[model samples]
Target: MGRAPSDSAGGDRLRFLRSFLASPRKVGAVLPTSRRTVDNTLDLAPLEEARWVVELGAGTGVYTRGILERVGSDARVVAFEVDAQLSSILASQLRDPRLSVVSDSAVNVARHLDGAAVDVIVSAVPFTSLPVPERKQILRAARDALGREGIMLVLQYSPLIERELRQTFTYVRRRLSPLNVPPAFLFACQGDPRSPAGER
Candidate 1:
């Protein structure tokens, strides 16, 4: 119905998995993301100059699929999935050489980025579950890694992050997509976030 999810989806590895009952941990897998979240997240930003886009928590390659479609062929997408199963799915799906799937925590965003400044960051992580400091870390990483004119697109289900986002960014714009499963909000922010000319 909605464009069949995305075009650049890596392969047929991602079969529609039904919710399975097991350990508490396994049961949590039932929280699989909706295609609407992915759609809303990627649709928020224009992908023209997204030379290097970092996708945090690229679960099951949903967001990854959308990102690959947006950027140019020469552009690179560095995606991170902290879960083992999701990481494997991401690796299999994004078999193309364009994507680099880091099977680790998104908080290690700085290390994972390898000193490269990203033109944009599209995130699908549920920031509502995290503590304020953790969210701040992620936001700081986004702002710190962005080029002067760069931006960060965070599609969170909570509007509460607005208070925190205002602390770091000069400008913050929010859009709502009620079509999503949980109704997501796209937050875009930008600023002259930079370190001193020669600080080490």
Candidate 2:
């Protein structure tokens, strides 16, 4: 018999805690993201019309599942998770052909894209915890990976990434999701004029 929904949820929490304990900086949060925060983050992304979507730091498949629900049947989602165990669990649980769980760092996102233009990029990455050079590298990769009309949606516990987003994208919009655990900031960014693909 299949596991009960509550059991599955419990397992996810346990796994998330273990991952966080193993790598506090990479996992960022002790608990998985709240559903409200996931909704707030996705609300700004153009997922319904997106052909290719990239999710950075897809912990426990919370936002990954949300992305699958919102995108069309033909859409593709590439979810990056730095933790090997989390990546493995997410891939096995979802088992959706539309989703690809990449066991790699977000900085290597561009390499996995195979040059396909991404329509929307959703990030749960803990930029504040990363080294400056690494953060900038990932941001640059994300910017260059997007198509002309692409948008990048970021959910962060702090607004520390706002300046970086503004510098990378010509248009950056911020919203607050206060109902989330610890409250969170959402950034919807587009219009990277410097992108080789042109303005977005």
Strongest candidate by lDDT? 2
Candidate number of the best TM-score: 2
List, residue by residue over 1-200, the lDDT tens digit for candidate 1: 01224433333223323212322232123344566766666666777557899888676677777777678878888988766666776686557656899987677888977788788888776676666677678778777887776788877766988887777777788988787756777898777423343121
- Please identify model 1 stretches exceeding 4 Å from their true place: 1-37, 192-200
Model 2 Cα lDDT, one tens digit per residue, 1-200: 12112217788999999999998987888888888898899999778899999999998988887888888888889999989989998888888778899999999998899999999999999998988998899998998898888999998899988998998898999999999888999999998867565456
Task: Return the lDDT, model 1, position 45.
Answer: 74
Cα deviation at 59, candidate 1, in Å, is 0.7
**TM-score between candidate 1 and the true structure:** 0.79
Go through the candidates in order and give the C-alpha RMSD of each one to the true structure: 5.2, 3.2
TM-score, one value per model: 0.79, 0.93
> What global local distance difference test value does model 2 have?
0.88
